[model samples]
Target: MSIPKYNEIMPNILRYLNTNGEQKFRDLEQPLAIEFGLSDAEIIQEYDSGNGTVFLDRISWALSYLTNSGLTERPRRGVYKNTELAQAFLDKPTEEIQIFVKQQMALRTAKQKAEKAEEGQLDESSDLLMENNQTPQEMLNTAHESIRQSTYDQIIDTVLSKTATEFEGLVVKLMERMGYGGQVKNAGTVTQASNDGGIDGIIREDVLGLGKIHIQAKRYAKSNTVGREEVQKFVGALAVAQSNKGVFITTSSYSAGATAYAESLNGTTNLVLINGEQLAKYMYDYSLGMQTKQHIEIKEMDSDFWDGMQNDSKVG
Candidate 1:
């Protein structure tokens, strides 16, 4: 069965606390998983951002909502118990409980906002109560991923519109920015337009130019698939240049035959194939053809600091 949503988990949490007495947060997870009849895989399914498991995240938000609604209390850190008010909620249907919690949370938010405004310290921030099932962190991750994908699409489109020579120069610059060429001036160069021997660009791996990496750039549309013939031609170009390393970058995917051919020559020739998706990702990661519009930092409490204070009090 699919894991229950946060609101759906609320009633079960209340019932467990009421029956089981005070419990630590970690101790609640197993029993809750059993109650939901969730498979091991479902319980451990990670969010897209790889932050935490979806099941645990939902459980955490459920507990937070219950605490804010006065249905539960944390008497000690990481330890939760049901309050007398929880008894009233235990008998209610899950839908009614959800509605009550939402209303209580709304009231709490309004009170906090009013207090902040009175102090002339009100800033634009989202309310603590989330309307969707996702936790606050998950929401932020989704937004970040969406923005990145949009930027990648825009970059690919812009690159596609440029001339072939311009595209070759761009890839060479990208290689230099990616820590190739080792601080050498003009270490990467685009070849002349005609009679370039299939190699569009080249990067000297060191200042002395003892080692070199040949580049073949193909600015093909998404509909076009680079085949083994193109890869073979690049390999021939590498042979002509007396180099064993080459990068074949294209704004389109490669055929299975092309990928297999490259893999077959793994020991004899070193070849790196960068497709449209991978190319855009590399550009975004290296901050090429894109600029940062905003940056956000997420922070958590320093348990060590509080622990030190407690130890100091004991010594006192």
Candidate 2:
């Protein structure tokens, strides 16, 4: 899952405060990260997209918004104590969280405008928030998707960097498990004699078929990162093989410049790169020429699935 930015997170913050009355916001800082599903990756997700962590920035914004409208209070700079106004909201039902956030934002905006008029200057906070309130839902949705994809890409990159030999193995197995097996060749050392210089092996697109997908399996190590020079070399290899695409795997990292170079060079060829960790995961997934007894059971909703449904529902 992608990370939620402050704007995406504010609504949830208000809900948690409204429902979990066991303590005030001041006492709840440490728990909000888990409560809101924020993690290292999510934090990166937010940061990459100019958002705040769920615990610190988003929660603070929610509190400030509530307090600005008299729904919460702060006894000190970092301490938030709920007020009678907030307590009164407890009985209003969960749906009220939205109303509370919206009202506070509007109220805060009005107050900021008034202050701006008196001071002969616009409040930057107010301006920062003004756009937050007016942003279209579609824009928010797109931003969320972008953040999620960015985070996923980062995850993929990290997995690639950390799992060199493993990730390449996974893609190889994934290709096979996905039905490229037997048809896909392996480099005795992961490449042909020259392996076309870029081609690691070739997978026959179909069994008993002449069509093939040329591959490049690189077990990239941290100290040995993939670079534009490697990409260019791979491109040259592709020409040698008379194929347009190849897979490059790394267990270390890619400079940003390397990625851009790969994406832009020779639009005709599709270059796929998998770092190390991803390879291991793929191997584990395909069980291709690999074995493991570790088992996972996915419960199903088939007939007789509700055998205990009535009793369980009643107990709840």
Candidate 3:
């Protein structure tokens, strides 16, 4: 069975605390999963962050919602217990508990909107409330993802406007930034031909030049797609160069037939196809034409180290 939603899990968490007294945050997972008849797979499913299981994230969110709704208290770090209101809410219907938490969250969101508006800050249409009730870290992740996508769109537009030679130069610079021409000056060179058998550039795989990666870049419009015929021509170009590896980079996606054709030559000639979205991502990742505006660090409490210090303090 699928894991319970955050709101659905809230009442059970309060009830569990009411029965078990104060409990460490990590200690609540198995018992709660068992209580809800969650399958082993459900309990162990992971989120992209790799911080912990998805079920644990949901449970932590549920706990935070309850804490915000004035139904629970954390007397010490990572240890939560029932408040006076928690006992009464324990017996309440899940819907009722959810409504109370939603009301609390709505007020919080409204206050933030008012504060930002007072500062004359303009933002995208703000939601009155979020139903999933993301934690603060999750909110930051979502915001960063939005900003990255906007940057990618701008990168695609700028790249499509470049001249053929300029586009080839950009690809060479990107490849060099990806550690292609390490310790070797001028190891990446553009072919400088508009019709050089579908190849636009080449980069040495290492300083000694044991191998080379042939590049074919297409600065295509958003509506244009690189079809199988174009890929076949690139393959022919590779064969003419007597090269077994090639990179076909485009500011547009490949057709399904094109992708399949490239994959079919995996063993004979390794063909790597990078579409517009992925191209933008790699450019951004390698800092080709982007600068870091800010750096934010995400940190967690080191429980084992802190607990050891606490034990030593008691002994002292």
Please state every model's RMSD to the true fold in angstroms: 4.7, 16.5, 4.7
Q: Which sections of candidate 3 miss by over 4 Å?
A: 1-5, 31-57, 104-132, 297-316
Off by over 4 Å in 2: 1-174, 181-196, 207-209, 289-293, 296-316
TM-score of 2: 0.41
| TM-score of every model versus the real structure | 0.74, 0.41, 0.81
lDDT of each: 0.88, 0.57, 0.84
lDDT per residue as tens, model 3, 1-316: 7878777888888888888898999899999999999999889987554556778877888888788778888777778998998777777899898898888877776787789889998654446234355555456556788999999999999998888789988988888889876878888998959567778999987878889999999988988999999999999999999999899999989999999999998579989999999999999988999999998776878988776654332321
lDDT of 2 by residue, 235-263 (tens): 78778778775666655566676788888
Model 3 gets an lDDT of 0.84
Question: Where's the lowest-lDDT run of ten residues in candidate 1?
Answer: 307-316
Task: Name the TM-score of candidate 1.
Answer: 0.74
* lDDT, candidate 1, 1-316, per-residue tens: 9988888899999999999998877688889999999999999999776778888888888888899999999876667889999998888898899899988988888888888889998755547446675667677777889988998888889999999989999999999999889888999999997888999999999888899999999999988999999999999999999999999999999999999999999568899999998999999989887788887876765767754653332321
User: How should the candidates be ordered by TM-score, best one leading?
Assistant: 3, 1, 2
